[model samples]
Target: MVPALDSWQFWAVLSAVFAALTAIFAKVGLENVNSDFATLIRTVVILLVLGAIVAATGQAQALGSISGRTYAFLVLSGLATGASWLCYFRALKLGNAAQVAPVDKLSVVLVAVFGAVFLGERLGPANWLGVALIAVGAVLVAQRM
Candidate 1:
């Protein structure tokens, strides 16, 4: 039986699947277009899709109720996402997606560390082990071949 969809792990795995596809698709698309222009197109598509969802669900109506702190952090997150996309696309344009994607996954390691320090999230031995494996695997995948 499938796990409940509400679980974060399930969602994270789904995200990983899509992220892997994103690299493959972006690599294919980048072959013919300027990476920056491609990024703009992708961003526009995402905005349209998500805007439609928000509108359809009446979620947009709640926008005014968002707290200032939440809004600030979300804005910051959006900026960070944009910057990451820009850099990721540029890197994908120049290198193999397989190599680039693993290197990008290093962000997972950074997140673990940052979450501990900034978010006060506790990371036990298993979490640290997983982080280490990710770091080593990223290096292995990103090696010159």
Candidate 2:
């Protein structure tokens, strides 16, 4: 059997747990602070923690070793992440965390589709069904009843 530490599923679950905590914590944290400023603080904390982890693990690499293409893509991804965090924080500030999180999770559906169209990733009918269900579920859960 594969060790849990080496399993993608294990890490994914941990990511989900952390993400859920992020929403709850950010909701509480945003009570008095501006959402954009809160996001900036969160980003700084993430940078510091990740930098320490990389240093401790001896995973730091020379910047010159990375390809320009890689740098471009990473820059784009960083911009996207910043935009997503800004939007998510704003949503959390103005809406219930429960509702905001579900709507934000609609990104899963988008990723599946975008992967197929942009990355030539293939998904079978069952996977497509799951994506559709996720979209529906997100919308349903986000409804203000």
Q: Write the per-residue lDDT of candidate 2 for residues 6-103, one digit (tens) a residue.
A: 99999999999999999999999999999999999999999999999999999999999999999999999999999999999999999999999999
Instruction: Provide C-alpha RMSD values for all models, in order.
Output: 1.7, 1.3
lDDT (Cα atoms) of all candidates against the true structure: 0.96, 0.98
Model 1 lDDT at residue 87: 99
Top-scoring candidate (TM-score): 2
Off by over 4 Å in 1: 1-3
Give one digit per residue, the lDDT tens place, for model 1 in 26-139.
999999999999999999999999999998988775667889999999999999999999999999999999899999999999999999999999999998999999999999
CA error at residue 59 for candidate 2, angstroms: 0.4
- Relative to the true structure, candidate 1 reaches a TM of 0.94
